[model samples]
Target: MKPSFTFSSNSIRLSYVSWICIFIVLLITISLLPIIWRGLEDFNPSDDYRLPYELSYDYWMFSCWCKYACSNYPIVMIGDSVVWGQYVGLKETLPYYLNELEKTNQNYPLCANLGVDGIHPSAMLGLIKYYGKSISNKHVILHLNLLWMSSKKHDLSDTEEFRFNHPRLVPQFYPKIPSYKAKFPQRANIIVERYVPFSSWVSHLRLNYYENMDIGNWTMQYPYRNPFNAITFQIPYPEDKPHSEPISWIERGMTKQDFPWVSIDESFQWDSFKKVIKLLQSRKNKVFVIIGPFNPYILTDESLNRYKAMKKDMENWLKNEGISYVSPSDLPNEFYADASHPLKVGYEMIAKELVETESFKNWLDK
Candidate 1:
């Protein structure tokens, strides 16, 4: 009753051509993926400046900006790698523990961490100026390590580029220094890189791949939940101490031209340190300082005396200014992953001590 519907030879040929065209198009698209997804690593600032794909200050700044843009976090932690939780996971960081403490205490202060590796007081001063307003009228727990004041590696120049480029709700105030040459992006590059799937995928490969190769743990490829932060679940053992035998405490395994025990007051860092305090006070942000844990194994009799003297000087200064502070005096050697950074147990102890403090409680209550 009806004509049979079937493809003629010419129509069949046309269908085959169409299918081939679609396959070719997909092949071209797949070939362009890497170029289209060229990420942060593609733009190396200089020969000396290496881009960290994971748990970088840039990522932290970006995350904070996203979280705080619409909502505010009452508690913000600021410091260097120690506070950033290097060699640890996002869940093991001090801020994460503090959040746990908040839940345990039945409080509702949302905590945000802005710690980046190698951040000193001068950069911190600049950071506060830029992002302090976001956390204004909230409790600011600032990690004050003497190493920032004492370490030759910690300088304003080290932070110049990172501060200039990292995302912030407020405008960045870059110092007009001769050394600073990188131009600031009109929009937040960090946010752009984060949302783009290709860039983040590349970052995960870089962060996790090299890390596994370094530790001979290639088998444990997907060890972290938050790969953006490069947070790893690898449990470090005592045999895994970075050095074969303990190196000099002051030297910390690296041999630099300048000794570490140099006077903090004489360094230009003191000026930035003072500025950080002044800026926080001016912003009406409650500033609470916590001196991070140092590996006791690094201390010899001589280095111990120098460390104590520095601590005493810092304590006197805080006391005179009536700045509430706590310096943990008894961190054990076993709790350390390196000369300065602590293991999970150490982070837990630090968070526990800070959250239980009357001063921190009073500041939050106020």
Candidate 2:
């Protein structure tokens, strides 16, 4: 005869409640851990500081940076890798040059670099909306890189799934991206992380300490190594040297090519950029735009003509919106690293032009 074991209804109910209580306690503990850990660190960022290149995808670190910048710096320069100084070092970036130019002036505001690599217009919108809550009532310099509009693929308009940078920062559900191929669970996880401090904190640990691997995989890779040993509590510094040699496009063997430019009226990236402007404005930010000194030396005549027209259309919109903007003249051919990014000397030239512009002066005064 087999012995039958069955739990009573009351016992079953009690066990269910106990499990729920355990979950609640675990959630609270995890959430509080990040707060406590962050408090223990004595993080004091210096001038010309930017997020470490390795931590570019760590939104938690970015959020903490945003709060710090909001508290200390009055001017924040936000954009893609152009603002991030892709072809140059941290001290050679646009924000650093801006700070240097302002240092001689009376009552000059300190500028902070809030740029992220590969963050196009769409991702920029999501980043500001979710992680930049502390960026209110400050002067924000937003860079517009027309390179994203030069092709459907870069603009995220191609009807194909391809990986792009900062996938978690883009819209997860509504207004789907054709190039993004994240599944439902992945998308859901990203959305949850944006709203959950603990998830992002865990991601920060994975990226900065665990060689960008999850605990399960990391443990498997180093079976005998203690996981806690990886947490050295030391933050990495931003790469001080350029990713590539600081040279002109021509020196790099880049020749003139025709770019299939998209119309501004139907461009997804342009639309997203406009939304970014509106978001900043809604937060009472004093927004100033910098239209690219996009290198015309790398464009075919026809492509250059199209680019000029597109630039004109963009200028017209800025004028109509009454937004302060500067479209500086192209730097010397040798100053450009590519069609968009500028070399160290190029950034210095651009900063000089910006500081001398009447519109820029007026915006800064305001």
Q: Model 2: C-alpha RMSD to truth? A: 2.9
lDDT, candidate 2, at 355:
94
lDDT of 2 by residue, 1-366 (tens): 666986466533558888899999999998899889777555677778888888889888888888989898989999988998899997899999988888987364479999888899999999999989889999999999999899888888888887777889989888988888888999999988989889999998999889999999999999999999888877787879987788889889998979989889978899999999999999999999999979998999999999999989999999999999999888988899988999998899999999999999999899
Per-residue accuracy of model 1 over 1-366 as CA lDDT, tens digit each: 777896466633458888899999877775566444333333312111111324344432233342352154566777767776665665666777777777756555457666666666766665555433455665677887666544433433343443432332122343433333445663355334444534434444454334524233544665653444543422121121221222333435432222256465754455567678778778787778776576656556667677777777877887788888887656665666666777777788887887778866776776
- TM-scores of all candidate predictions against the true structure: 0.57, 0.93
Q: lDDT of each prediction vs. the true structure?
A: 0.56, 0.89
Predicted structure with the largest TM-score when compared to the true one: 2
| Runs with alpha carbons beyond 4 Å of true place in candidate 1 | 1-70, 107-110, 151-259
Give RMSD to native, each candidate: 12.8, 2.9
Clashes of each: 0, 0
